[model samples]
Target: MVDIEKKIIEIIKHKPVILKKIYELLQAENKEDRRLIRKTAKKMLSDGIAYKDSKNKYHLVSSKQVVGTIEFTKSGNMAFLSDKNGDEIAITVENSLNAMHKDRVLIEKIGQWRDLPSGRVIRILNNEIERIVGQFQKKKMFGFVIPLNGKINYDFYISPENMNNAKEGEIVEVEILKHKSKNKNPEGKIIKILGKPGDPSIDLPIIITKHGLPNPGEFPKKVMEEALKIPEKISKKEFKGRKDFRDQLIFTIDGDTAKDFDDAVGLKKLNNGNYELGVHIADVSHYVNDNSDLNKEAYKRSTSIYLINTVIPMLPHELSDWICSLVQDEDRLTMSLIMEINKDGDVVKSNIYNGIINSKKRLTYSKANKILENNADENLMEEIGFLKETLESMKELMYIIRENRKRRGSILDIESGEVYFEFDENGYVKDILKRERGISEKIIEEFMIKANETVAEFFDIKGLPFIYRVHENPDGEMLIQLKNYLEILGIKFKIPETMHPKVLQEILEKTKDHPLNESIQKLLVRSMKRAIYSNNNIGHFGLASNSYTHFTSPIRRYPDLIVHKMLKKYIEGKNDLKKQDIEKYSKILPDISESCSKKERVADEAEWDLIDMKKIEYIRKHIGEKYEVFVTGVTKFGLFVEIPEKMINGLIHISELDDYFIYNERDNSLVGDKTKKTYRVGDKIKAVVAKADKLTLQVDFIPYENYIKINKKNTKNYFNKKNKNGNKKTFKKKGKNK
Candidate 1:
């Protein structure tokens, strides 16, 4: 068989010939040889090894060709596409099928001359984007909207009829009409004109509309009216059959700007030497009835969107802020989870109840941290002794809970510090600061996670229908890539006997304090599957839990509201919760989960865009200002630097480097080809802000004129192994949340 296959290939080496010609050329006189030839030809064609075109001639499929999703770089010079089989291929923009970033495409290998194969797009399987955010420019009869995002290389052509009277040079949202052949550009229509791109208030609206996010202005009036009708004051009749915790010293802790507080905490020591910890979440489901206008609106939005300048809430303010918020000194409906925890952080007993509470006080993270860390308030210490003890006891309990969680192999990704923006009276940026998560934030987080776990366990044991938050195990191929990258950073950990969360958590801890910590963590996070809502109990791999669901923050998230309703029904003596309503929801929960997850991602992207725009605007004014920055990445063309104060990254272009430099592929560094000077990853240098482009989110930096190159002795090939595809020195992937 092997001899026949090779002989046949040699016979047709130069060109594809007719099958009749092949049968004659082979001199097959007997039926046996003829049968073997036909069998081989059929096998080759069926397995994609050979194919016959319209002319009825056979040809071998070119090597290294496949179909995958094409991801673009910020500059659009090159593209990489990867499929589920772990195969990756690269192609140049010229070979791209006008495939926008993240679009699926069919590609064929053009050459194998280089170590890595180069491909050309044959067909586009899917164009994932439907619209874009851009600036409109009027033409003679029509117009073009230039995409603000750099990955979108094509400008959308718009006709005058679809312009909607948009002015020239205004930021606008355009809906994509068509994206035809590779030779043609994508066409679109102007749906909304957001004022000037630099306008603080106007840009946000354009982003929201561009992403198709829910808008507060378009909220249903029926839902608004129903929310307003909910009384501010709690009536006596509404408190019946509800546990009243108004006398308890329950209070809320949140950010200083938080208005719609969702969860509150109270703690006390039991006479039996145990502790009773209460986690009370606002009963938003009580006010927003099932299948009502308010409920439907909340389901549509799925999650509240917090942006730089404003919030797009999941529910109207009348319900989220005024009626359901756990405000201080106000009666609010709540669903409380009271756990009696022993000294070892084990729950001895637990109960869930429909309750009412009046918060004693509202504490901000700053003040709460002070009370935990400082013992200087003498006058208030005597009067607020209980408050102090409550906090101290809570801290003790938090330690035990956190320790137990770590033991359970829960993975924590404390990767990046949040860049917080404070605006001036005129809506311009006043200050930018990096806010590290402190103990106060963890106190609330630990308790909420415990409560959610408890609720999920209760439902699971009773065999009830419920919505769960599940994160599947990370992709093995991605993990292998991550492990290779970590080895480059001089970090190491066990890969587990098979695959689990503990080993990843161990690696996460080892990457801290180094300059590459944030980037490494980000890469590891990108390797893992996204956490999502589901009815099937797959168990959360990241949390390392047997059962888990979101049972807190119903005021800001819809799934929590659903959980609240279920809890209420079960606590009211229907423990199994196997009613017709439960069965109906169980059937549709998969679709609901999918829709909510997609919207959550959209909300996240929109929020990030708003922040990125504001950051660029704020940084642009500081052009020519020099600041020290750490070298987070060393690319073929430039060095990527992260500013300490702003926590934002900018590029130090190779052209900006005084001496001409050549990229060193093996070491992930750059060397002055003539001067013998070098720049390595993790080095600190000062550079002036050369440019900050809001439209493209591009920031460039240049070294100070007098700054000298370190030229320090360094290791060789530190970043030697490029990610999976043929070790291209310029292997780069752009976009965020990775």
Candidate 2:
């Protein structure tokens, strides 16, 4: 109703409306009008937007309100950007938009709207996005491209000549050429024609184009020729001034399908009873020269875009898959972070230096875990006795470090759902399963975290300008709302006067194994602020680390690449950076961080959309099949049920219920008014898939009895989990209507 009121105000602002007469007009404006218009008509009178006339008909108020867009140019420090919706400015300048030009958005600069002195400038602190990408559909006369990005909210009108010879149904990248007015569709032009959407080879390209990804054409001629000239193997000459770690029994651990190994690890027990752990990362900076075309391409991409069955690498195949990859038995260049950890997991000493390494073997998580249990392939273990011993020692150190982090209030082990599909040899959907992580994954994670943290602390102590992964404290208001939400769910908890990581950890510990833990965990994560890149050292509230920066996987992440370059300069004793240089970087870093963050977000959305799209396609086949679902949310219309294993949420519409249901505003549940039966949220129930629409990415479910059922065993339906007390509680009818 609030949304309808807002929409009505926006429409009425243009002209006075005969409320009853405009019913069809309002309905035609949006597809969701059926649900919204009913409440809007009533809300209009209550909100004073409409009044009864002499004839007893409703009339809209003469003075109307609408949101408009604005763009601002800076006059010194204060930056302002306007919205498409008028003079209203909501430019939240992040640290990345500090010195952006008029062409760029002034993202993340917080400003007040009430009243301000003339010319008062504002500094930046956050960011937003620009440009949209979509699919091109040609018409008989003038063509229009439907945007794949929902945020754009409008189709792009493409001129015949501007189609760039793209055929119909091709996934072409369209750039907004002109925005004449808010009412008119923006004119666009085809910048790149990827290919037909359904083609096997075009899958990755379509996702890339839809997200405006920069997968620059097969390395420029010069870059490729240069890459070819670089010798494949690192000789003794190239290892000058670098610590020699080739004989240190180093090994790479990754998934079985992994092609690129950017990181490797080694371990040794020193005589002093301290464990010496070495995290050797591929020296991508050593190969990709700063300001080179290869480097520039990597910078533009910012980070690797990995999707289902496809990976768009930031670096070329020549580097990412070969030269820069720490392949087993091949001598490769590396930047090593060697640390001595005492029995208590405290870092007694550490050093970051360039080095050379030869990976002894590559082990997947499953294989590595088996090796840890001494139940792996015997031939290799027999040949490499030290490898097995070192892995065990590494496992020991991982646990010690993990416990140390937990003691310091670091919240690292938050469980989340993952779904992945398996395809057959012919590319048909073979199976989809929930992916799980084990101790093998954690061992590698523990090592990487240590490396990244140590590198960040080193640069911070040196007072150098670097991009830090900063997670600000959660909003005070948001936490209060979350506390209230939990209380409503019958979980009473107290919020600390001073918010800390331990506060959340304690509440989560209390909620562990509770019936509502899954949803509560997700909501808690939603309440927390998103981690973003910033040049300022505000500390990462999530990790409980005062120093945190991305220093691993330079081949994939731009910030890591930048960190490697800075680290190289300092480590090589070439630290001639001055205050002016630092100031110059201060302005430039904001834009870089903002751009990188936006690019990463774009990639994430594209990946998630593809994942959801396929999942919907998979679920559509199970229509009419009955499955157990847990009620995760309650609405006026229905109960929202979530398939536990798949993490798929679907709505069980109230209309689909056998009995007449009334929405209970008090408990936020659907109540059977006559029968005095209630269907409260968090209640488990059996439901049948009534409908699944890919276009809306929505699944509709019906109560098991109301829907036509099918054999559940054939579909492998997973049952709901039991409570901590090992009780599987079933609701007969919300406990006799409360």
In model 1, residue pairs whose N, Cα or C atoms come closer than 3 Å (at least 3 residues apart or on different chains), thus clashing, are none
Candidate 1 C-alpha error for residue 312, in Å: 0.5
Q: Candidate 2 on 573-678: residue-level lDDT in tens?
A: 5543456656767656765776677578767877886776566656665665678888876778888888877777789877667678888665556778788777
Report residue 554 deviation for candidate 1 (angstroms).
Answer: 0.9
| TM-score, cand. 1 vs. native | 0.74
Question: Against the true structure, what is each candidate's TM-score?
Answer: 0.74, 0.73
In order, the Cα lDDT scores of the candidates are 0.77, 0.69
Q: Weakest 10 consecutive residues, lDDT, candidate 1?
A: 725-734
Clashes of 2: 28
